[model samples]
Target: MKKIKEVAGNNTSDLVEMNRSAIVRILQQMDVCSRADIAKITGLTQASITKIVAVLIDMGIVTEVGFVKGEGNRRSIGLRLNAEKNLVIGVKFSRHVFSIGVFDIRGKVYTQQETEFGLDEFASDVVVEMKKQIHDLLKKYKNVVAIGFAVPGPYLRKEGRIALVTKMPSWQNVNFVEEFENEFDKPVFIEQDANAGALAEWWFGNHGRPINSLAYFLAGEGVGSGIVDHDRLILGNLGIASEIGHISIDVKGPACECGNKGCLELYCSANALLKKAEEILPELFEEEYENRWEACNRVFLAAKEGNEKALELTEEIAEYLGYGCVTLINAYDPEIIVIGDSISQGGDLLLPTINKIVKERVIPEISGKVQIKISKLTVDPTLYGAAAIATDKVLRKPSEYLVSK
Candidate 1:
């Protein structure tokens, strides 16, 4: 399943970018904070925050709020994001849906949309629709400096060509950067959706985390994972890093699209769950998903409202999901594990149990600090990661964020 959650931080070099962005991200998160607070959160010196905030103010990306005067202290001026100053576009395409999002420099998605079409049809048709969307967005904002796509595979590092995208029909080895570049004549950044979602969580969702390694499980139409180590994305031996969902659990359970038996996708993905529901609960199949939104909502509502059958099915999926997470955690020793997918709509009702299973199954201390969480309902986290991809290419300087692919 592809995660459409867009958040900034798609690049390893991004946080390392001019350091000004680091300061801005810190300030943007807080309504208003003193320079000392910025320094405290970012480990940057007060002098650095002063210099960076100065440049940001000049760029009109931030503004100084009022000052706080305390009994033995001098008045300190607070700063906050100038959210109206600039805008970025986060565009994403998954198996069955399309999204066009407008975000601010703070990486907050202010205006957004989710569009559905045939997965086969979308792969071929997105270009035209995106072109029109781009045209319309540019006409209104005019200064949208960058746009990013949450792709399913790694792009060739230098040439920016997409490669090895198996789930996206006809998109394998396609040079999306070149296509989008020529069509829009703007910088089009692309990144793996799972990686993008993790970045969003690291940056905006779970900021200043005490832990290092994190596994972000994104479930939608297909399943995948993103890993970050020491604030950097782990690209694995061949940039095929975090293919968690494709891992064989049952081995002889069921044939997966990727040619493996009982792949996690067959059991955990929305498609798989819905397919099972059809056999177990034909009543639901009669109505159709109505759209992805309604489908997850219905299941989650049923799970929350104590529908026995729904709860049982949810537990079954959660058990597999938890077991798969165990494998990833054992391999990586991640500090945090974020679950983001259509199934996540079940929210706390789903994750607490998965957390329990993983902790019980994993070695004691190793699992202690690991946090299993559901992404915020409103933020399509991958979108912000796409925004971060745009920010990485355009705003960040060298040495800020680092990555292999």
Candidate 2:
């Protein structure tokens, strides 16, 4: 009977909201539980639980279901979150493509669409198209309570502009907050794509409960990471804390777009993998690819089919990814690390080498406790992460976001 600790709030109202949020979060993960069960888990008095549950039930955020057995084997009413009624829109904006999805707080996806744009395409035009599509989805799904946007890092969260985006300099000037904050009627939450991925894995991914910390290593078109410690994102002063991709793996290596030499991104990103793939396996790219994910998949398929060159290339990439994991473990000491995005599609081919490297590089005690795995999210982690961003916010202050029926 380990009790879940609640986050302390500043004031009376804040404490009330935090208590409600804790209850809702438990329900979100557990699906259904009794007031006595919530009280036991949260360490809140039965009276406090009753008051908070009443508010949540009145706010249309929680509903009473059939009876369930309590701690002492007594029957008690079960309360569940009204997740289907509270939806969120997740938008993943990246170098070559943008995706939009509608999801509930429980990470259930209703619909998702992807739009690809050229690197030469105007940023303003892309924003216009994204806004139009979101509007269309909002019109269709009336239950949507908020919107979550995930942009590439090193995104300046406070400034609401991307500090730098490789090969896409034009996007640096666009203030996402100004662009989307007032554009939609519902509140809009913006986060770096990696951070979004972390939140997605934290709230949605099947990683089991009570995770002390989790790190999401994103190795897609761009390289980055997001960290979640104790149900909260580890956002630094400007909300961009874990930019692991820019960490220099080689001090004397080629200069990266971030002005760093021999950065991990240059060695392990989808761009990096494709660069080597095209040189070693020319026939694989005889035709154009719909996206980098597809291009990377071709190489993985080649390796899967026992192509020696492709296998070597994948091992090399996996070794670098392993290096990234080692760094993540030393830097954050997360309970688990999830490798995600396009590169993770090679999990079957990549894990053996990656694990071997980690086993060699890290201490036995540290390496033994840390579990590394590829993301198993059905939707793209970044897109699903966008929804998680909103879901995280809405769950925190249900009264503010969810309307009372």
Candidate 3:
């Protein structure tokens, strides 16, 4: 016990001078631990924990929650992060819309707002509109400390910018972090949306089962995947991995924005499915022109009500998605695959078929253990992801455990 506390104290002291990002790491690991418990767990001396906790308390970043009991009437005082003290901003950028949110270090989304910028506006008008949205939000809650972003395309982690193809022409290769930081005069961080969503699932959603390995499918304006194995996000050498949306299943099929033919998103994304519906029900567009979310939900409800056209469209979408799921299942051998974002509306209609295809395509042994389903955290995946990013960044660093105490 003394040795452990010493180690924890050393770790605490070692990372003491780090900014919020490194501090968040320590807090994330101290979830169920008291200040003393944290000191012991991190192998830091109690004195070090005292100083850190004192600083956090003075800053209103940490607070005493209550007393905790150990194995046999062992009493300890608990500490929790004060998420309401400092506001954090997160923006999830997609081709058609942006999900904006405000949170604190405890991974709570206190406020959420979204704005739609059509395909025609992603470059020229999007940044200006984004600034307007931020100003508008600041009018409501102005204490934003830092901003984190999740962008649809592959991005360079170091520079925090779009590095590769994006359906939106203007955003491609744009150094968003530098641009936003220079413009807003605040620190900025950016990551891939799917990766952020996967981190959200791992940190806030159900990942506690023996199966920590997961494949996260995000079917929004585009389809993408984020792979989590052994409780860590699998970011490859290029800082991008699990881009299942662009996987070409049909060599001769329709061309994709990623310079591929017959990519999964061509058939499975909300945009792709909406486009398919547009060809069949052109009149539906006359109404929900701007807010297609409602219209898309109606498509799912129509399928649920057994509308033949809706059913066919939904099934077509499911088949393509099932193929993508199977590919991910075979490749990653995940214990579970969570589907999130817009396509999750068809989750009930999608999961069974996805499992069926995986069963047919993958090894039966792996298929039996793998569970494929949609995230219950859908309506707020990006929101929660952004909040988690704040928790992770602001708190310092998240340890390997989901509940790290």
Candidate 4:
């Protein structure tokens, strides 16, 4: 196959940049390898690979990690990325919980913590708490270069504020980027949670396939989608384009805050699933449903264990979710759709039904053999994704972010 630069027709400077990105990309995928292996994979000459690797090593981006035995007692030194040299911080905020993590350029987390908010706390308090955590981390580590915040709603790129995070009325119109940058004394980036999750999958979960296009669906208390096409994220004018939750699946059903009727989230979100469970298993809810999240988990566990009622309810939720996926697939024509967040905890019991319903709803021409799968990073995609966005700046242009040792 031809190289990426060959098809893109890059000039000398662009070619150089592409070569650097390719080298870093190879190292990221391989995690550790000999210089010869990198040259073979990147299709760069051995001399060129040596030159680039030497520069990277000098800049503290790559390090020699011992060696592997070769023929006749020869040892080939394995080079690995030095992710801990410079740290990037990732922050994610939900209604009741906030998470902060420090990650290396390769998106490996070095340290992380989650804090839950009390019922009456406001956005200012959240910001203060986040700043305190970051300040403490910086004093300890002292190498953080950038911070990324993943907000749960539309984040305006130009204004640098979160548009509207439902249920957390105090967070509306809050500028996380500005607030974080001011407090932490570092560059900050804000992205929709779903969009950040999509980035995480593409940057870290490629699994050596390197898919150029895919859709990541975040299905928590609300539903949203993050789309990547041609290896680039599609953020609309306000930086929140794919609000799948607001997509009206039923015109005559209940009204939504976005002025739509029967939005996808109303019927298919994790909250919606739990609500369905509450209605179907009223006695169970009365006794065991202490938390909404716990209730959602129990419902899925029951479905996985072949409980007839739970299975039937899960199928219904999957059908509604499939409707949203069908729309996403038809509109974007992505190669695959990865579903994450609390609802995905249903695991195998949830995927097949979602796949079946999407296949049934969409025309073959539109579906075009799209595959729907569960997220590999099922725990916290947004947190990793936020870190990826910060680190990606360094990866794409190492000269800008890498400080000479």
Candidate 5:
């Protein structure tokens, strides 16, 4: 965890900041550790560690958990992050659903709920619903530090507006962050859903090991990826770096809403799965499910039960999804590519096919060591991603937001 410290030809203040960051990151990972252990792990001297811990404790960021017995039966007090001292709100907004979560500094979900929207729900209405959820969470808990929104399409971070959401065109031109901040009067972070999923995996999915680089491929309304290299998230011009779903796989195939011919989303998104299901067996959906989301779930369940048509659809999706992985493998060359979101409900049936394609089609030099798998998050990855965004802000500047109120 000492690697979390950034060294930049250290000035005295910079050096101190680096030590503080390293200590906090270590505490975050370990939950609780003795002062001797912190000093040993951070490579900071006893005096430096003691001074920094005192400052962090004064700032209300770290607290003494309890005493631990060491060599010679000596007892030392353990330090841990005051994770519950502040709260973060995470919202995942899609075409037809809004998922809200309240989380603490350690990525624990305090409470959460999901609400479905009507086909004609307006942007203002969506905002109102979000305000209600945030208000309820606040009513139950105090010291909310920030809020984060996980959106479906490319977001212009500079402009603070959604660039486009193909499934919900009305979301375009909406400055969601501004509106959220105005209502809540707190800092709000906006990010593409896939990128959020990526952050969640990097921060929480690694099981205490550091991930130098990885890509999270989120398949939902559309396919997208969040790319991380050297522990940094890569954002292209206008924060639209990994728009993989819009990448055209077929030059002469069906035209897409992005005005591309045969984009990857047309083949592998949750919507795409339902589209094919309706095309092949219209009656399956007409009589059973009330909406496309449920119908898509039905298809995945059927595939698991060895239904012929359902299995065929899974193979088709795996072929295209795996093809997308090839492109990601070649482009980012991540150590692991995690497939998540609603589309991943197909689980083993879909995962094997995608893995097979990446192994067979990717260049041996690049794919030789790449590991691909399904998401391991017990809670929704996107929700954790939202919390990660806020958690990152707090970690970077404890002085700014982690102080006693």
Candidate 6:
């Protein structure tokens, strides 16, 4: 019910498809429901529900499961989505690593693998390896219907290129659309990492129902935010809206790769935490860390162990993260804010300080109503988000992408 949006279209066929999408989304959430239940939830007439369900059954997208108790103790046929028959591939591309996974429409992951590469690695070579992995997965997962790709923020949707990646300049010119659009037999959909995270939370997250708006705050290699309002992604003109990482927190702060001063990313990102940790807690860095996440966790672990300096460093990062949350609340007015990514591993050590700052900074009336929680997704949010991007599209037009057994 929370996923349903108001249907609008001038064309009758388009309207019908929209209605079908609504029904499918409901089944995706509820798992099983009667036509009467769907009609009541969607506010559509039972006749329309019957008509839509019949077509969906004919298409093999939906099937009658059996009789189930309906509202008022009445008996009605149960309907459900044939989720196992439709699969998607999720690909997450970052500076140091790229991950690919196979997932069904219901967010069940079949398999995933991560490949690490250096900053100096040829972008073309990395992409080639990525394609090879994806091609291999496609061969093994015959049910896969589409592929979803997630890249760093400020990604130009129209141009299909990252306008600017923090440490990776070579990728800025690698047109993702040109490289991926025709590379696979199945349709490939691309979205910025933050937006993809938002979709992952929207579709797969268990944040309770009827979430009018949700914000996903990403604090890892880079800081960013993604917003989902009323079951729709708030994509700006170039599909880069809600990029909270680029928002300047300090006008006089250091210069950022995004050509801005004091961007939120420079302060709360894993790199920022590492820089401060190196200065105050140099002993923790005696051994080289495999990645930024490991280094950041070292600081958090030290804080948990009662190291005063480590606690201070984590508190500072938490304050910056709190500032990011405040900005998210003011800009998007999300019902819930979900903090995720490498930095979120701080867990309990970070929440108290972050929540305190938010309570002090935001008006009580607003702050009291907003719920903040760390992401509990079993899979990496960005990787799962890649699958969600494809899932969102397939659900919108089931007839075109979803295959019948």
lDDT of 6: 0.92
Q: How accurate is candidate 3 locally (lDDT)?
A: 0.71
Give all TM-scores, in the order shown: 0.84, 0.96, 0.81, 0.88, 0.90, 0.95
Q: If the candidates were sorted by their TM-score against the true structure, best first, what order would they fall in?
A: 2, 6, 5, 4, 1, 3
Between prediction 4 and prediction 5, the one with superior lDDT is 5
Query: Best-fitting candidate, measured by lDDT?
Result: 2
Of 4 and 5, the candidate ahead on TM-score is: 5
For every candidate, C-alpha RMSD to the true structure in Å: 7.1, 4.6, 6.6, 5.0, 4.7, 4.3
lDDT value, residue 108 of candidate 5: 81
Error of 6 at 292 (Å): 2.6
List the candidate 6 regions with Cα displacement exceeding 4 Å: 1-9
Q: After superposition, how far is residue 244 of candidate 4 from its true place, in Å?
A: 1.5
Q: What's the lDDT for candidate 5?
A: 0.82
**Model 2, residue pairs in steric clash:** none
Find the 10 residues in a row with the least total lDDT in model 4.
Answer: 1-10
Measured with C-alpha atoms, the lDDT of residue 171 in candidate 3 is: 73
The models' CA-based lDDT, in order, is 0.70, 0.93, 0.71, 0.79, 0.82, 0.92
Residues 130-155 of candidate 5 have per-residue lDDT tens digits of: 88888888787787888878887677
Per-residue lDDT for 1-405 in model 1, tens only? 988888766564444454875665555556687888778878888787787777667766667879965337878886776655556788876766778888865676678877777646645466777778777887887557678788664444455655544456466545676677767745677778888777667656644545567788887766788887886787765555787777888888977656778878778877777777667766655675667657766776877788788888888888877987898788877877888867778777777678878888988887786777778736676667777666555445312221101
Candidate 6, residue 391: Cα displacement in angstroms equals: 0.7
Clashes of each: 26, 0, 18, 0, 0, 0
